[model samples]
Target: EQGHEERKSGTLSEPQEFHSGFIRINPDHPDRVLHQDIDNIENIRSFISAARAAAFSKPVIAIKTGKTAAGALAAEIHTGGKQSSDAVYDALFQRAGMLRVSDLTELFAATQTLAMHPKLLKVEQLTILTNGGGPGVMAVDSLLQSSGKLAQLSEETRAALNKVIPQSDMTSNPVDIFGDSVPARYQQALEILLHAKEVKNLLIIHTPSALAPSEDYALIIAQTLDKLPKMARPYVITNFMGEDAAYAARRLCSNYGIPTYRTPEGAVRAFMHLVSYRRNQKHLTQTPESNADDAKINKHAAKALVNEFLAEQQSYLSTHQASQILAHYGVECIQTEVAYTPTEAKEQAIELGFPVALKLISPSIPSKSEVGGVVLNLNDAQEVEQTAFAMLLRIKNTYPDAIIEGFSLQKMAPRAGANELRIAVKTEPNFGPVILLGEAGTGLEFAQAAVALPPLNMNLAKYLIAAAHDKGVLKERVLPEKVDKYRLCALLTRISQLVIDQPDITSLELNPILASNGQFLVLDATMTLSRYQVQSHRKRLSIRPYPIELVKQVTLKNNTLATLRPIKPEDEQAHQEFDQSLSKEDRYKRFFGELPQFNHDQLAKMTQIDYDREMAFIITQDNATLGVSRVLMDPDKIHAEFAIVVRSNCQGLGLGSLLMRAAIEYCQSQSVQFIEGITLPENTGMIELARKLGFKISRDFEEGSINMVLALTPIDKHG
Candidate 1:
């Protein structure tokens, strides 16, 4: 009875009622009878498992209260002791993939946010609008607290907002009106923010004080938001006032598909979560690259280990065995041969290579660096012998009881660029193997890189490499002459695939993945494993040919026509023609104004099409092409870039939009998330056409161009 009443009072009957969905759980139990009726631990576990299965698409959030031991004991009367029950529950919830809320306020905000913006691309990049400075300040503070960024207002956005507000108002971070604003003013501000280039999500904060009536402002705000493209923008309204004002605002906002919260903090957190979820979803849908060789290596090693260990009933392989596995998977480790004596170490160095690194390889002592058992850079036979003797004596003196495996002599790798990277893996109970990439060397512990759970396919591997600071550094700076970025990217991709295929790898460290003197090498490596560990869910790798479908074709005036087909690698010639036709000014606008010379490598990357993420079509008349339109999907395939170039003779024929419309239809048919295009502000014709096509256009001062975004969802079927 106690549990039943609590469930009836707290839980929603139909959690998936809305198109955008959310799952809510209330931890507060008022009825005491429920505590004595059921086995709490067993019941909670069952409920958590069921909820996880039910809310796979929606975000299931659990809100728990009561922290005191007395309360815990009361709960334990039906469940078990506090410690065991809490631990089990925590693990259960985490395993079941439910997001736990710290407070009731957060829970409510999360529910509304999820309900309003269920799709990932619909959230993130928020715009803030407020009437008074006090509320504006509070909104900004709340946004920062929730990790929501203040979007930079575009020039057109500023001009539009200025038309409504006084010239003295701040136009950048927060659009604030000095005095009481009318419905027109609120609507104008919201419109400007919604159409801005930088703003994807919006937060509207208004205080229902004596200055302006709360109900009127709420009605206007709601109406304005409803007019916006359903997939392009999402908004949250906050009313700081009496209960009547809050209720009015919430009702109006909800009616217009805008989420409403009483507090700014809750609204901001909801927006942040929405953006994060969208980013993760994009990562999930990215097409994985093929790394079949790495998979084969892992398969062979796993099979070999199973056969070798079966007779002896051994669970784990030794370092040598693990090294062989890694070598097969393309991980470059040190070249070392076990040496029994100092003379043997000298001979081994001579036999292997010059300038070798000598390290104590003892099965008993796992961490050689901690035990002063490592010696590096021995140039000659005499030096190798001396270093080997010194390392052995130091290790023996440090730990007399430690068993010795012969000295490992490895070739000393040259220093590379400043960036040293580490990719480590640890097994999680439910998420399986979690891969962590970070800065290596002395300050490695401080510079934490990106993390992902396996199966590590091509797309995830690319993301991990891109997520690191090294990739950023490479992008910003000029690479050394003759440096190969593509090769490095490929190597990282191979390493990630290897780790995913080989889960027996407990700890794998590759310090100083160096790019030195136009060459890349793994300077050092150490791998460890748990003897009896078994990976439960092994994901299979597969590759299939890209799918193709015939989309709409367009015909322009003067009989210039184009049959839009899926882009392919063989179309590099057509891609070159489009690139060559671009005027310097047009090229500058498209590439952020840098007139860098293009090479074969650059052209390949720019023109490469992954049908899942990007597509480009050519306009041909009698096999003589006039123009081409390219659509490149953004990182989160939710947004795509539309760039078109036509031959100079065909400029005024409306061919661009025809090609653009074709691209838009293709995007819609493929279920592509969103579409974005950039045109110079001076190109009035293009801007007008974009607006006519229902694209939300914004002019940016920084880029000296107009940005247009079109949401492909709810696509006009006839168009």
Candidate 2:
């Protein structure tokens, strides 16, 4: 409509209209001249911008047609240039935040599902309803094909649904109503399923057949949906029909606020997309803090380099330059030096220490190993010289006209059991700066190992790291006897931010990220640059002094003063003082066991921990630290642990109870799981505090303290 007005007034430039129902791009005429005047890049950009804006406001879905060249040519004849048209449309639509549908059926389903339930609060739980076994099977197949899930029904939901369905019918998720189901039965089944506590969203499949009246079923479904509460749940309905029944079912479902699709596959795809978007939204709302130091480090290094690269208009940086960038981001890369000659290679190898790796450095070749440009485990000067010469010769033979800049001498890192970690950035038209992390091996690429699109935040970064496969490996086995999980998590967090902040990055490949001996290092790296490459910018979030007024309100003992405050990262010295004040026995009891020094990882986890579910508080009087308390919650909110470490000198002063009281109050406010604590049976001080706090104590094995449990009750308002 806007385009029509602009065209009539001769004010609009290159008017294009999207299909009303399916958001597919179609130019005004099919047969047209293939030139900039007809279909220019600017027009494409405008189209993309419009689509993206619509998607942001409401869910915009697209179905792309014309896969074969012939089909494309036909489309072009009806529109403009075939090949260019498809490419341009795809690039534009993707940027505009429209989900591309593979087929007509998929397109319909995606639009229908998205239109009905545009947003999701949770993605893990799903419920399905189908009338016939054949359609149910097809729905299951489509789900698997599109990576959609057939969620396992919770026991409670299963029991509830079973009450309304026959015993012969499948009671699990994807509840098949069978051929005998009538309008009344269908409505009752839907009501019971919707009311289940575990079902977050639902997918209904209604296949009109000879026996069942499809329109009648659709009417019943509509009536049931109308009776459901606004927040009961959202559902996608798919009706497989031939002409008359399909049209009737689609119109009926659409009229009643239900998104209707013609096929099951389309519905599943759209549902999965909704699920993903919901997950991202939840993550964005949860993670609030940004690491300023990491930003500063990256900015200081990226600015000058980005400026130089942009000035030269270089699409990619040399290995040496790339290494500098990695170092700036605090990523550990192999020890490397650019050597102009064999002698230089030997010299650099010796300087870097023995057992070095030699590689031919060429601007043209990105994958050195594939081209036989890499030589590993070259010990001594002679080995380095020979390997460097051989590598250079191999490069020369592989590409006779290739430019051989020089050789790179790098110290070979110890071969430890490690995984390939590739962090790449791919810009989607609608979604900006997607950071991908996966295992580096062929299997990872094949499996598409756990991908998370965390929206450029440190907390999301941490969550991504925790979700990765390497996290399990680090927790269960990584070496140095006790690998620093916190430090590794921080590294992942920093890497995510680096990719998000740096726009000049076209693609980055880091293979064989070795996690060994309590540290991680990058063995090889390749960083590609985009045409619009520019230096990265630093991000800073304002920080103010801790609120003193709020801290003073928290008190200990009869009128004794205690300060509440925010902790600084540089408080390691004071932390040590607080630690040393505890008896060896007390320290062991608190830490499980501890004798070594606290590393940066430990400090970061303690000081920069997320304040949402976990928090650390210190009780102090006149600048003298009395004790520290920490509240930890399980991810599922099923349980919480409160651990307090008080100074031996301050034990009997009721400081432990003060910290415990604060932790309990916090847990109750968060509506967290049960508050639990463990104390040595002999630690009568802690036991007494628990008893005074009205906790239910339970004694376990005699090896240590009795386990204490506290059930929080709402504080009385009118006491």
Candidate 3:
């Protein structure tokens, strides 16, 4: 409607609209232009996420449709198979740093917000200015509904606002200016709110009133907002109530590049788009530690466990077989064994100690508790035998068609009031495996589950755990010590890797995964397999997992055997320690200044990088931090920045040259046009290293740094 009005008034600047969702900026063009349309979405993400790994000056914004049940069905009908291929498209979009907006209103608001204050993506604080109590209340409710917090004014700020508005009216988040408030009152309130150092962003609201000069007040706020310095300005979103009369004011605000919304609720929702976008950008920059250890995953053993069940022509593995599978992957489960006879059950119970559980194993009866086929806490041999026999008799009469094999015996492991969790891997028709971690038990709530498409690493696993716990999905039981999160993250990574390796596994369930004391034990489980397998296993995951194939062991020039591999998420601590070991001078050469201790966010950004567009290689022997090399690719994936540092002790062993060669080769493979770095003029050692590697040396006096570039591959001549 706004565009039509602008077009009618001869002020429409942007005259293009696109059906193609993906966008790009080509240097060959005069300006940005549409290049391609999605003809097919067979491998949806390959196209949906084509721009995810590329480096861009601005964020890649996306619109995801079909999140609702009716919309999903329509999409499936239109697309011919899936409403969406990946169940976790939202997750995929987030990992790629794409800002996903719900509707056109949000798309416009969020774009304007980011355009005005790109740095505010991660800022969460908000302050409000309103002229009416009812509108102020609505604005506060909307912000809270979007999971946003209202910035509390300091005592000094409150006192200042109290002087302008009445004390009774000013004692709140939305410093409510009275209904009869004039332009001066709006001006004073905005000044007080914007200057409060606690404020990260500001929302100015106006509802139509008899005394309130809605249009005049908006122009006043706009002019005041325009005078603020761009560098320090918080993202300001305005809500000028009603339409026709407010159109000119809205246009005036838009002319100044300030975002104005139709409703307060829309404005808050739009602000959250910036919130979610920046949070995801943080997620993108944070991939430094891959947390991938090839030594941890034994593929041979995992395959062997799966094949045994296939050999027996069993589609579903029983609790005993399921426990064996988890055991191979280093996931602890209750010790379980199958007993063929009553005497065998008694012997198994005595061997496992008192208070063991006996469950009747059958093909048809999936849940033992349903058919009276489970016996828990059998204290003695006689009781075990009696319970085992009774369970078999009960299952035999009730489930006549069930193929009863034997009684499965497992120790009744106690959790001692630890958090009981449900971890399951379910497959989609085309998208492959999605892992769900949430509250456990038969009476599970849908709202309490958090889902992610895996292959997961320690960092991603840690994110899932924290998100679930924070959102009230994963709860803690009464326990003195909490469930150790590190161990849980490691275990989750293992489970994710296992599913990635075994393609035929249809579904897996580990209910009541008792988590406590840095240990996890699966109390009960069921794993089903299928003859059908995904053709391309790599495409199974929506987000690519850690690339374990890049890990290698090399002998340094000093004859020291060292492991040279891509940096993992767990390398944050090692990277920090490596930074601390550097001398003040060395740090100046590398970081270009004296360095303070690296904080968690800073260290995470340095270590945790998205493996898609960049690579970091570390050389370590006996887990000691020896040296590190990193190459960060531009959004275009063409230009790259290469940096290397070998600890002072390990210098002059040809390690620095070896790392440079590796980084160059890696960049060439990634189709990077050139690799470059800046060094202090006095850093002769680094300058010499660049010369030996056939790089062109130049001095950027303006930047006060020596610049070097090594072109690996030439650009395409045809274009």
Q: How well is each residue in 1-719 modelled by candidate 1, as lDDT tens digits?
A: 00111221123332122111111221232211110111132223234324443333445555544335565567566444332223223333443344555666656555555555544554456677776677678778877765556777788777777777876457767778655777777777777777776776667777765656777777887667677676665555454445775676666665655566666665666676566445543442333333534343555665466455545654333344445666676665555477888999889889988878787767677557666667677789999898878888887888889888677777876553434455555444323345565655432321254554333444455555565544242232343443344555556666656655555555565654665453455655656554435422322111111233344466677664566555544456666666676777666655656576576645654444344335677666654556677886543357678887676666777777777777888778656778888887766766787899999988789967788988787353221
Backbone clashes per model, in order? Answer: 3, 10, 12
**After best superposition, candidate 3 residue 94: deviation in angstroms?**
2.5
Per-candidate TM-scores read: 0.56, 0.55, 0.77
Best by TM-score: 3
lDDT of 2 by residue, 426-526 (tens): 54322234445555543233125334442233444555555554333213445435434565556665655565456567666666577666677777666
lDDT at 201 for candidate 1?
63
User: Model 1, poorest ten-residue lDDT window?
Assistant: 30-39
lDDT of 3 by residue, 424-448 (tens): 8877655567787887766333345
Cα lDDT computed for each candidate against the true fold: 0.57, 0.59, 0.71
